[model samples]
Target chain A: MKRTPLYEEHIRNNGRMIEFFGWELPVYYSSIKEEAMAIRQKVGLFDVSHMGEIFVTGEDAEEFINYIITNSTFQKEDHSIVYSLMCDKKGFAVDDLLVYKFNKKHFLLVVNASNADKDHKWLLENRKDFNIDIQNRSKEYALIAVQGPRSIELINGFFPIDVAALKYYWFAESTFNDNDCLISRTGYTGEQGFELLIHRDHAVRAWNALLDKGKNHGILPCGLGARDLLRIEVGFPLYGHELNEKINPIEANLGWVIKLDKECDFIGKENLKEFKEKLSRKRIGFIMDRSKIAREDSVIMDQEEHRIGSVTSGTFSFCLKRSIGMGIIEKKYIDIGKLKINIGEKIFTAEITHLPFVKIKN
Target chain B: MVEVQDSLLYAPSHEWIRIEGDIGIIGITDFAQSQLGDIVYIELPETDENIFMNSAFGSIESVKTVSELIAPVNGNIIETNEELAASPELINKDPYNNGWLIKIKIEDKKQIEGLLSPGDYEDMISGGNE
Candidate 1:
């Protein structure tokens, strides 16, 4: 199993370690629900070093990346990040990643750790016609995320960079305690937060410094469990569960990121456009009326007990204090409303709700 | 460190039984509650429902995962810990006392013989955390 640079730090903080996609990481430090609520109310630090970072440089980097991603980045501003998906010719998703356009000639792609090698190989095979130099920098950097309402205040104590003014999805290159750092005003948590990409050797120092500086701000070191719940509460699609090789971005409720009007025909543009026209299934948020908890792969059934769809991600929401989940249901039986889910022998009544089971206050 | 009541009999599934003749009070062990993290919901069997030995009676939902509550002995559910319906975190705080899950009318007293002692129960969970 691969252990990140923060593995020792996690052990020191009494983190409950678990294996996630070959990486040994913390499931939770204190408690999952408490850590999640802390991110909403105060501040939380996450050792996200397992995330993959790939650098694309050279003259034709911009043109190549635009064709690679579903989101068009032809005229994107510098220092901005765009969430996009890379799919196959049949419009099946390979991975969903963040494209950080550093400049016209350079870009950084932050992708899920489990999909790192596959994504890199996918991009490498498609760089034939474009002048680009691709480098896998996943081992070079350790990512840390300071998330919550007080993230800005906590980061200010370390390096007083006007983070409040930093627009969302934008990043700036700066030095933190004499170490080169790339700070991004982006996070999976739907709150005011920042993700710091620092050198691997300097990760421990940054982790200790953040915990010390954030002591007065009610900051706690969280784990992957809390991060998953935070994302689910905000209706974000996880690559494995909500999206996969067989899942299209349209059915995953990520059509907003796919640019259909871009003049340049991307790799999956034609299939995606056709899939959009025949979009039969749609993703949605739901709350189980029964006290029963729903989980992924739980079959969604109509009132007549006919199978309609299946759950993608489900969790007991700490914010709502109820069972909330995201599921892809058939568009035909969606109006039937108030469906039932048969986890096994147990059946639960679920009411269809809008995306984002819980709202994020600005 | 997990707390175990010395007088109570335990099941390998992490359930503890405090027997008083035919009536047995059941709750999850401290080790089980610790493994479960913050308890969000405990689906308890309704009163007068039949519960079988070594079978799933209900489920316990935490923030991350859901685990089935296995019955340690066969009996009818005389009463459930109604307090858990409103406040499930009590299991995390006090799993051995106020957080008892159910009270069952033990159909056979020999069922307690199959349970492990406090020392044996400690040895059971000495393996790595799952």
Candidate 2:
């Protein structure tokens, strides 16, 4: 299994290490509830170095990026990021990613760890007639996310820039303890948060420094488990769980990221437009009774025991203190009736709720 | 580190039973509680329900995963822990005492003999030299 640079640091902090997508990462430093609660109530740090980063440069960088991702990028100013996805010609998601426009000539794509190689190869294959240089620089950088309502204040205290005022989805190149770093005001948690991207060698130092500096504010080192729970509470779509090659953005409730009227025709524009017209299944949220904890791949059913769809992700919610899940179900039943989830041989009753299961502090 | 009570008998799946005359007070072991993390909710069988040895009578739900509660001895449930419905975190805070789940009327005391001793349960938890 691959180990991030902060592997030993996580171990030292009593993180329960687990294999996540072939990377030896922590599931939780303490318990999932305490760590997750810390993120919601105070602040928490996460080792996100396992994510993949790729750089696109040269003269035609803007056009190359515009041709692939679903979101519009040509009008984006420098030092801004767009949450977007790359889709196949069939309108299925290749991967969801954050496209960072560094300047007019350079762009950075932060992608899912599992889809790194596939995304790189896909970009290379589609580089025909475009003067762009694509390089997979995933190994050259490490990422750390400081999230929660207090995250901005804590980060702004130590960093040179006034990051608390940084607009959402904007980033700036700065230094921490003399090491050059890039900090972005973006996160999966439904709080004012930031993800600090730095050189691989500086990961451990930066992690410890943040923890030490923010200790008084009750900053704890959280792990993937809390991250998953936090994201699910806010209705964020995780790639393998809530998205995949067969699930398009429209079905995933991510159509807001797709720009159909942009000047440049993206890879899946026409196909996605057609899929939107014939939409059958829609991603929706469900809140289960306290007795059952729905999980991934659990079959979804109506109250009458007829199968409707399958759960993409589910958990015993730490925020709400109940069982909550997200599933892609038939659009017809999303409004009409109650839903149930089949886990093992047991069936659990649930109700359809709106997008986010928990209200954001913001 | 997991705490184990030497006087109590342990099931391989981490439930513990303390024999008290003809009664067996049952709860999840400390190792079990730590593994399950914070207990958010619990589903348990009703009082007077007969549960066979090594069979699931209920289930425990934590923030991360869920585990079935297996009966350690053949018995009829005398009383279920009703406090857990309102304060599930008691299982994590004190798995042995305040977090005790049920008191059962033991059908046959010999059923306790098949359960693991504290030392054997420790070996199982410590990975049994494998």
Top TM-score: which candidate number? 2
After TM-score superposition, what is the CA distance of residue A297 in candidate 2 from its true location, in Å?
1.9
Give per-residue CA lDDT, model 1, range A44-103, as digits (tens).
999999999999999998888888889977878999999999888889888999999999
Identify the runs in model 2 with alpha carbons over 4 angstroms from their true place. none
Task: Give, for candidate 2 chain A, the lowest lDDT window spanning 10 residues.
Answer: A286-295
RMSD of each: 1.8, 1.5
Per-model TM-score, in order, reads 0.96, 0.97
User: CAPRI verdict on model 1?
Assistant: medium
Q: For candidate 2, report its TM-score.
A: 0.97
Point out the worst 10-residue segment of candidate 2 chain B by lDDT. B121-130
Clashing pairs in 2: none
* Residue pairs that clash (backbone atoms under 3 angstroms), model 1: none
Which portions of model 1 miss their true places by more than 4 Å?
Answer: B127-130
lDDT of 2 at A73: 85
